[model samples]
Target: MRCQPPLKSMVYNWLNNNHACLLCDEPAEQPYPLCVACEAELPWLDDGCQTCALPLPMQGLTCAECRRRPPAFYRVEAPWHYGFPLDALISRFKYNSQWPLGNLLAQLLGRWLNHRYNEDLPRPTLLLPVPLSRRRLRQRGYNQAAMLARWLSGHTGIACNEQVLTRLLDTAAQQGLSARERQRNLHQAFSVTTSAPIEGRHVALIDDVLTTGATAQALASLLLKAGARRVDIYCLARTAKPGSA
Candidate 1:
């Protein structure tokens, strides 16, 4: 027999009377990890390239690189820029395996996406987290992108299929790679797991951060090749170089 748990957790918060801010030690304002002031002070990406989510001086403009050689994905939306305490928080959440931090980050991302839903943007039918190689998955014990996607799925009622897309190779870390180098490294690194009908579906690719966008481009290319009509990217933050504009 199969037992299905309720959509919402039945457990009550008896551990602490108030939820402490993840950035500061102060009490947070309802459901978020940061207090109102800290939230306001976050490095929000108010202006960026719509195509790739790279931070820019002006809004609603595509970068030169994107204009020349556009990414496989149509657009990307991220709430914050990868900087300062934000980077530190993500490091603790990702590399350190701090579930609470990851949860908090995911919650913020959900809120941002929900706000976008209220606007003009439409939600994707399927949410696919950028997959990790099996070797990396075993070494890390979990895929942070999957964790965030699942959390977002539960809240937004969007179906998340982590098994749909996969990493076929253990590519080198993309942190220090140039754009061309990263693209080369990600070649043949991702693949689709099933021959399911993805035709004409809008798929949202979720990830922790958008940097260089090599991985997202590779995954988006694969999804498009598998028959997806359009691919959109959603990430918590974007890392644009100082003078990359």
Candidate 2:
């Protein structure tokens, strides 16, 4: 038999390859940014609507809203609930140009998606970032969703196309709007670019967060209208309905 390396030498090599946790600055227990403890403590969405990924108390059941009116996207996959440090980190990444935070979040989500694909989740033919209107893009100096999509693409070898969908209207922010108001606000808000090749293809829409999902519905409808065979939503986090657990 060939001579084997010493156990001490193997341990030293393993330690050198470990990543540092972004949150605590300690040696990460996994390949992603956070240590095992930090990751375990994250506000993960353990149970939710199968179609929209809306957070719910019970698993294996659809939410009443989805049962009544389903979203345009056929399915949603998100890793976390919009709460705690995640919300704060996303705010900083979107508003303050803090790209490292966005990178950390993208890595976490990408790892989750990789595992999901292994479990037979359908991988889209194309990945598209939800478009930011010209006005908002100018004001913010960047589109957070695009950044996240690019980062995820790099991680998972998925090709991301940012120019396929265009935000036609610079609708007011959706933060203060109720569900109905949000849907109304996004009416006719998105249009497909003439050059986009959408026919008979499955597409995934990437975004930082999925709130009421009105925006997602509007865009997914446009993609389907443009002849996409199926559409899926991929976001870093999903918010619970008001007063929901």
| Model 2: residues with Cα > 4 Å off, grouped in runs | 1-20, 29-32
TM-score per candidate, chains pooled: 0.91, 0.89
Candidate lDDT scores, in order, read 0.84, 0.87
Roughly what TM-score does model 1 have, to 2 decimal places? 0.91
When summed lDDT is taken over every stretch of 10 residues in candidate 1, the lowest stretch is 6-15
Residue lDDT tens for model 2, 113-203: 9999999999987889999999999998779999889889987888889989999999999998998999999999888995357789999
TM-score of 2: 0.89
Candidate 2 — what's its lDDT?
A: 0.87
What tens-digit string does per-residue lDDT give for candidate 1 at 140-213? 98899998899889767889988898888999998878989999999998889873846689989989999888
Which candidate leads in lDDT?
2
